[model samples]
Target: MVSSTSEPTVVRVSQKGQATIPKGLREKFGIETPGEVFVYEDEGRIVVEPVPSPDELHGIHAEGHERGEATERLRELRDEEKRREAKRAERLRPSEDE
Candidate 1:
């Protein structure tokens, strides 16, 4: 089910509306079993791209940032968000005397 030429290869859809991706294309795109893919239509054509796992996406934005530093920054942001939520909840609580 692999295509050797650059020309588009034809495939048949199953009764369940599933089409098997060419083996060559799947290997080139890192598509794996139990993996996720993004499917969308643009203009008149459909496109399917593999979705990278969170582990694969880690450090994708590591522009001069250390991994540990990035993780610490995320933890700080989460703690700050939790503190803000707690303050907001306190302000919205009814007074015991009321």
Candidate 2:
């Protein structure tokens, strides 16, 4: 049940308990023929949210840095972690002479 300023549009549930989302609400929420939506209950009210595509989520974390810079930083961190693990393993290994 969606609330709006205008008169509330009543939707009839089919025999299978499926109700069609009103056209106006569908357009406002970007619900296409095959689009995905997240439906959950919030405070006893059902909430429907459109799921954005992966492309739409790209560069969402680019507020403080460029994508390439962030990727490079991640790579550097991974390399540093690998180096630390190798040093720890070497310290734990028995001497070859022993």
Top model number, TM-score: 1
Q: Across residues 1-98, which tens digit of lDDT does each residue of candidate 2 receive?
A: 65552335678989998788777777865678677776666456565655655565567576875666645754565456457546865876899999
- The runs of at least 3 residues in candidate 1 whose Cα sits more than 4 Å from the true structure, single-residue gaps closed, are 1-5, 60-98
Clashing residue pair totals per candidate (backbone < 3 A): 0, 0
Per-residue error for 96 in candidate 1, Å, reads: 83
In candidate 1, position 50 carries an lDDT of 69
Worst 10 residues of 2 by lDDT: 1-10
Compose the digit string of candidate 1's lDDT tens values, residues 1-98: 54663346799999999998888877776789767787766446565766655765577577976657655754565456457546865877898999
Q: Per-prediction TM-score, please?
A: 0.53, 0.49
> Which clashing pairs does model 2 show?
none
Query: Model 2 reaches what TM-score against the true structure?
Result: 0.49
For candidate 1, what is the TM-score? Answer: 0.53
